[model samples]
Target: MEPAPGLALVVVSPRVAPGLMSRSAWQVVEAASVRLCADADEPLAVAVTDADLPIQVYAAGSPALLARHLVERAADDNVVWLGSADGDEGLSDAIADEVSRLNDPPPVEVVVGSWDVPGARLLDVVAVMDRLRSPGGCPWDAEQTHESLLPYLEEEAGEYAEAVRSGDRAHMAEELGDVLLQVAFHARVAEDHPGQPFDIDDVAGGLVDKLVRRHPHVFADVEVSTPEEVAANWQKIKEEEKARRPGAH
Candidate 1:
């Protein structure tokens, strides 16, 4: 008899909530007679139990071993492969290449169980900036002031603009990081202001408040149908904000 008709490869992100996984993936996992993970101690196993499925741990090795095992186990019963954040793409690739060369290949399906939230790693950037400015931190970072960082800020901004103009995605990503570094650096330096100390949260909070206020179409019931209307509305909101400022004339 031929092997099972289909196999499931469920990929999950470490940071993502297990409940957020797709219903189809859950169905496959729930029906799985054999569930396997790369490691038993991995949090993915914990998430599997949380999802109300029994997952068994396996020794980590080449994808060929896993593929062969899945093919064999799936021959007798439904098998589910629960993968990690990066989703063992290497093993998956190797499995695909190996199975393609064979005369008989069991159908394999891949699904992402969960996805990482966008911009989640940015918190690391903020934390690193704060640590660099903290007590007993980097001496150079500790002593730098707004005046000292101004030149670098200007330079980074120029480079970022040039990258944007050139439309080179690689250069844009690099230059954008440089610009963000300047922002984080400035926010960190402001923490030492004798009269007024402010951190990245303060900076981000103000920006958030400003953005929410300006994008009334998004956050409020204000209806805007066109990009031009949105831009005009943002300008109007900015003027109102400026008028309400303490020193505004």
Candidate 2:
């Protein structure tokens, strides 16, 4: 599918609850890229004053400990939440930090805000940015043309391929993220043109949905004994789909 142009911000927030973090003690806030840690002696109490920033707590070994700390140190105006350790909740849907379990009473001055930091949907980002760039957005990103971005996309793809060949997991991860950025950048560009469903969500969502529809064994009841059988099934489905197209051989 063709790509469109858009922008996104990666933010980290404080982990509200904890279970196990002797391993990796960092977590990202869904709305903004603010990281929170309980292991550090110096609390980021002053830093959490930003009203726009989202909070995400990592409940590694002790949920109570993390929750109490956030409750005590968090600004009264700042929003906080005690969420599950898993990445199940987005920055916008998190619960507030003020409410506490009766078992452990911690000094609390911060009051909870009902408002949660709403996460920006992928499609929403595209639609909003497109509107902004329409004789309205900043001159730089708005002035960019598709051809100008081709080099960047090519560079990112090459880096991804090289990273894969190198067998360095970290490099591969970084490269893959850059490739994603390229996809988003291209989508944003296509969106500027007419007669196109140019958006990053459409590109990503279509690919995900297509993969699930194509892989019946993984998404549906269909089963296969061998890789050859799987390939045959996929081919049959593709041929049937092609037959419905305007031209097929």
Report, for all candidates in order, the number of backbone clashes. Answer: 0, 32
Give candidates' CA RMSD values in order.
5.2, 15.4
Q: Tens digit of lDDT per residue, candidate 2, span 70-152? A: 44443332223332223224322221333333344332322221222454334445555566556766677677777887898
TM-score of 1: 0.68
Instruction: Give a tens-digit lDDT track for model 1, residues 1-249.
Output: 333446788887666665567787777777777888887656667777886778888766777777777776765676788886556767788778767876877778887777668986777788788888888789898889999999999999999999999999999999999999999999888877899999888999999998898998999999989999999999998898889999999
Overlapping backbone residue pairs in candidate 2 total: 32
Q: Would you give me the overall lDDT of model 2? A: 0.51
Global lDDT for candidate 1? 0.81
- Report how far residue 240 has shifted in candidate 1, in Å: 5.0
lDDT of each: 0.81, 0.51
